[model samples]
Target: MVDNVSKQERSNIMRKVRSQSDLENVVSKALWKKGIRYRKNVKSLMGKPDIVIQKYKIVIFIDSCFWHACELHGRMPKSNTEFWESKFERNKERDAEVNKHYLSKNWNILRVWEHELREDFDGTINKIVAFIEHAKK
Candidate 1:
């Protein structure tokens, strides 16, 4: 299917897409308030994790339902079915690859879904804190 927008317009729209999301900002701020120091989007990392604690060998990924194709909430775009399908499939594959790489290196990895955070913000925060604390041990 052809794109709805002009080539230049599509380029501009894609350019506006950011590597960091507001969800990441909120979660990072909450963690910071709890005295959990971490780095954001370390490009040197294998997958460029959203949050990383080098001291503890921890990596956290805040995955959007749409982007990561959450089983429960992900929906294919009506406009570009084939493109979105391929994109989502690739995303899931890459996630698995990243998980494998971290596991092989003995790094603690946590992936929080968008709906999970939205459903229970405080609970999710606590879960993350617990995960980090456990990794510290």
Candidate 2:
């Protein structure tokens, strides 16, 4: 199956192939343990958030530091600076567009960078839990 697609096309489909971070996995587990249920990437939703709580009107995005341009850890690769720059820029644009679209529909957006979330899983979860709780009210 992997060999069926051209390398470039495969890259486009597998773009931003960052694996789930410890923070996301841990926090997600914790949330589940707390009986908080959410959907992962509803195709109908813009940007296909990592976590979406439709009832609570909340969306969560766990962005990779490298892919989403982590404020602290984001770095430009020297190998193909132009290509990476364009890619990152496009990602940023799409993110902003999706964010705006979600907001327009009265959905609260939470974007957590990989570095921040992994480095501080508890705090991140706390924020999400709190958001969900507040949204319920």
Candidate 3:
């Protein structure tokens, strides 16, 4: 499928997309209100997770439904189907690799989907807190 815009224009548009999303900020604020301390995208950690509770050795990933290819909400771009498919495949592969790395180090990873957060933000926050509490035990 051909893109309507020039390749350079498309590249510029893509570059304008924010790397960090609001989901991360929402979760961060929730945790802060509860007095739970966390680091955002720690460079030293594998995959640089969205949130990290060093005390609990827990890592949180605020996954985008579109980017992660969520079973319910993910869709391939009609304009660049092949390119998008390959990109999503690589993303899934990288996610798997990161999971393996964390597992080997006995770290707890919680991947929350964008749709899940949007549908029930409070519930999602509670679940993350619960996981952290459980890890403490």
Q: Of the candidates shown, which would achieve the greatest TM-score relative to the real structure? A: 1
Best by lDDT: 1
Query: What is the C-alpha local distance difference test score of each model?
Result: 0.95, 0.80, 0.90
TM-score for predicted model 2 compared with the true structure:
0.81
lDDT of 1 by residue, 10-51 (tens): 789989999899989999999999999999999999889999
TM-scores for every predicted model:
0.96, 0.81, 0.95
**How well does candidate 2 score on lDDT at residue 107?**
89
- Deviation in angstroms for 25 in model 2? 3.2
lDDT of 3 at 44: 97
Q: Where does candidate 2 have its weakest 10-residue lDDT segment?
A: 1-10
**Clash totals for all models, in order?**
0, 0, 0
List runs of model 3 lying over 4 Å from the truth. Answer: none
Candidate 1 Cα deviation (angstroms), residue 14: 1.1
lDDT of 2 by residue, 1-137 (tens): 12555779768877865555565667778889878899876779888788889987899998888888776899987655677889999989999998999889988888877776667877878878887888778
**Segments of candidate 1 deviating more than 4 angstroms:** none
